[model samples]
Target: MKLLTLRLTQNMHARSSLLALALCVGATSGEGALGIFEDHADIGATRRAGSAEYHAATQAYTVSGGGENMWFTNDAFHFVWKRVSGDVTLAADISFPTAGGNAHRKACLLIRQSLEPESAYADAVVHGDGLTSLQYRETRNARTYEIQSGVSGPKRLRIEKRGKYVSMSIAAEGEPLH
Candidate 1:
């Protein structure tokens, strides 16, 4: 005799948010796959909903969401992540689908401590207007701070973590990480 079986595994938070997401955006499991990350969107203090889709042919990910800002003590934005320890590097080529959106709307390569709204984190982000910066919050619920970069409208952004230090680099498409 032969038998077939199915297995399901999910974190409690992720399962709960997935349910809320279905009701809020009618999103499906396939629609939220962002290439490397199985989970998309962090349920936080946000007034809007977000979604992400991955295109295997082009090896690209598209994420869209609305948030007042990624500043202050808390944030509200779509995040796709995989937990990692020790040193790591994250880089991505990001662009907006339309020219019209909040000037502050941003795409980022982020490393966070937790899914909490005010988790200690750092990221290299590209804003709608081409502004690039390294933003971080050292402690939970603490004020966020930024170190603005000279590069503007970079087609690629990278953030690397080594020990307690984090560095950022940006470049135009086809250019080396600077």
Candidate 2:
């Protein structure tokens, strides 16, 4: 599959989880009824409300929100998710609708243990500035960590989970995922 994973081995943390895509959510989540996603939410506090809109013609989901960050032991962002058991993978071609916003703004394909900001999770993320990386937390409330990709400005970010391992891959413009 093209949309998929991380260098962090199975030893990092071993727990099953549900997957999410940042493209769409209700309580603070279910409102993001965009195509494939069943629910959505704003994880953690934010300065303003966030939203997910699906464009049928273009088959794209536009998700926007504000948060302090998705780092450390907590995360703040709009989460478009569906809970499922077993291994899963998700991929997205991320782009900021407008330019010159927070360089750290991230669009991610995520798998979270729970909706809480402190949930254990894994993601393939691309920042506003085109930095792509694989990020994850080992356990609930654990510190988040990542391994940056040497390649930047990729057109697609993919995340995958298999057993206790998670990994990520990217494809640059006109290039295949490695």
Candidate 3:
């Protein structure tokens, strides 16, 4: 919850492009699929083909296809908080309970911390297909980069930013990617 401005560094220019892409993807979301921290989200209706069960104890929500076929199509979900700046680090544990049947299902972590409710500061996502990548957008233009990892399941993703330089490291909970 600490707010601090990032100082310009050597790699600021390169990382800026990555940051921009995150904003772009974060801005566009499927209708009713996007949920904020305080919002009451219906996981089944949002994805249009699944049922979501919220676990109050863990503060995490799980979505499952209640015997219905489903895929995450433009379904965007994010946690909102005060704008964060400086050398910030964000991490999350996510999984696709139904990933065994659908490879297109996905979950993502958003960072940067912005006041603009319409967009995120920066964000990255991992698809159920075992492709880990980062996506960012400044305004209308957006970009995606594939991370080098073919393993998937339960994952812990971390994004760290120092000045304009940013780096992402990911690993499965029980095994190493290498």
Candidate 4:
């Protein structure tokens, strides 16, 4: 599908609280009211609102939102998600319409425990610069941690949730997800 994704880690100082520029995300999904999703909304209190649009003809979703960052105690990004249980998997072919935003900007396939900003969660993410990683928060209000991947600039990213552990697969440009 010729997509792009991102990931990042390491506790560095956060950027200034600037206005969130919309992140252009194009993804392939199923047909439903909002594609294969139950609903989409901002995960936490964000400076600006986020939106999600499903294109049936293209089977692509354009999701836009902003957040201070997708780490630490709270998050503020738009999420288009469905409720799933008992060993689940989520994947996406992602790309940004524009290039060269924040090096830390990301598009990810996430599994979160709740809608709350402090909910425990895990995400297989790709960053603007093509850094990919598996990031997680073990408990609500806990610090976020990351495990960097050997691969980068992946065109496809997938997350599989087993009983208690989460794993991921990544595909570079022109390669299949493995």
TM-score of each: 0.78, 0.80, 0.49, 0.81
lDDT of 3 by residue, 1-178 (tens): 2111111111111111011111112222222222212232222223232333344434454443221111222212322232344565655555554424345444545553343333323455565566676544433222333444455443766556677765666776644322
True-vs-predicted CA distance for residue 134, candidate 2, Å: 0.6
Of the candidates shown, which would achieve the greatest lDDT relative to the real structure? Answer: 4
What overall lDDT goes with each candidate model?
0.61, 0.64, 0.38, 0.67
Model 3: per-residue Cα lDDT at residue 128: 52
For model 2, where is the 10-residue window of minimal lDDT? 7-16
Question: Residue by residue across 44-102, what tens digits does model 1's lDDT show?
Answer: 75555656666766656655555446688987665666656777766666566656445
Off by over 4 Å in 2: 1-32
How many clashes would you count in candidate 2?
19
Deviation in angstroms for 17 in model 4? 12
Error of 2 at 56 (Å): 2.2
TM-score, prediction 1:
0.78
Q: In candidate 1, what residue range of length 10 has the lowest lDDT sum?
A: 17-26
Task: Give the alpha carbon lDDT tens digit for every residue of 1-178 in model 2.
Answer: 3322211011112121112373212112322446567767778765555666666555576665655567799877667777776666666666655555556666778878888989888888877677888888999999999999998767777676778998887887556666
Every candidate's CA RMSD? 11.3, 9.5, 13.1, 6.3
